[model samples]
Target: MSTVIRKYEPYNRFKGYLVENNIKQREVAEVVGLSVSQLNQKLNGTRGDFSATEIRLICKAYNISPLDYFFYD
Candidate 1:
């Protein structure tokens, strides 16, 4: 049997979206129900990744599709 590994980097996509859309980190954190500090930690790779629920909230708040994070470059 063989195992395959993939690099999943949604954080970078999220950051790019923020920059492109001119959305502030604090605004995203508030919409996703996280403290700005916690959001920063996740964005900076110091804390755990965003949960499925959090991702959904972010997409909903920003009117974006979750697929944008997973499928696009």
Candidate 2:
């Protein structure tokens, strides 16, 4: 079998959380006060890091710890 690789490994855990929770990408973008494309760019590592406030808002909206999504092994 061929191995498939993801473009955004750093956010893989977060992506899983979103999927498991049935959270939509547009909702996340709204919560973070960003456009969907902008959010995608950030998640894809094409853009730089998210601002502190953006992270806080996302965590608050989802009631998730940053470590669970941002900091990964």
Candidate 3:
């Protein structure tokens, strides 16, 4: 049997996007209809993953593609 190792940090990409674009977490939560605490939980990996609607709203607000949020090198 063989094991595969991956070095992907899922949420970091989103965090990086926010930092790069100067987007505030509070504003994003408001626009996405999430509570600031909820957004923090999601971003901090304490809560579950973002819903599809939330993802769409974040992308829309930042004028970014979903790909940018998920996969940035």
Candidate 4:
């Protein structure tokens, strides 16, 4: 069975936050413990799959609650 990925707007929001903070994408990748290329791919929508650990890391990095990043309709 195929897994359905829910829409998560926080990725864009998070990117904006990073830019607003003058945080480089590579810096964010290092801070979030993700590879720079991997993070770039994710940001570009070339990768839509992320692990639970990644989600937690992202939330931690952005200081946003996990629940705030996601919703299902």
Question: Which stretches of candidate 4 lie above 4 Å from their native place?
Answer: 1-10, 70-73
Tell me which residue pairs clash in candidate 3.
none
- TM-score, cand. 3: 0.75
Ranking by lDDT: 2, 1, 3, 4
User: For every model shown, what is its TM-score relative to the native structure?
Assistant: 0.75, 0.80, 0.75, 0.61
- How many clashes in each structure? 0, 0, 0, 0
With a 3 Å backbone cut-off (N, CA, C), the pairs that clash in candidate 2 are none
What lDDT score is found at residue 51 in candidate 1?
85
Clashing pairs in 1: none
Residues 1-73, candidate 4, lDDT per residue (tens digit)? 9864544333665566667889798876886678999887676556665567877887777787766543223
The ten-residue window of minimal lDDT in model 3 covers: 2-11
Model 2 lDDT tens row, 1-73: 9764434444767778888999988999999889999887777666766788998999999999998888767
Task: Itemize residue pairs with steric clashes in candidate 4.
Answer: none
Q: For model 1, what is the alpha-carbon lDDT of residue 27?
A: 98
Any runs in candidate 1 off by more than 4 Å, and if so which?
Answer: 1-10, 70-73
Best candidate, lDDT: 2
Give the per-residue lDDT of model 1 (tens digit) for 6-52. 23343777788889989899998998899999997777666777788
Q: Give the TM-score of candidate 2.
A: 0.80
Model 2 Cα shift for residue 14 (angstroms): 0.9
Model 4 TM: 0.61
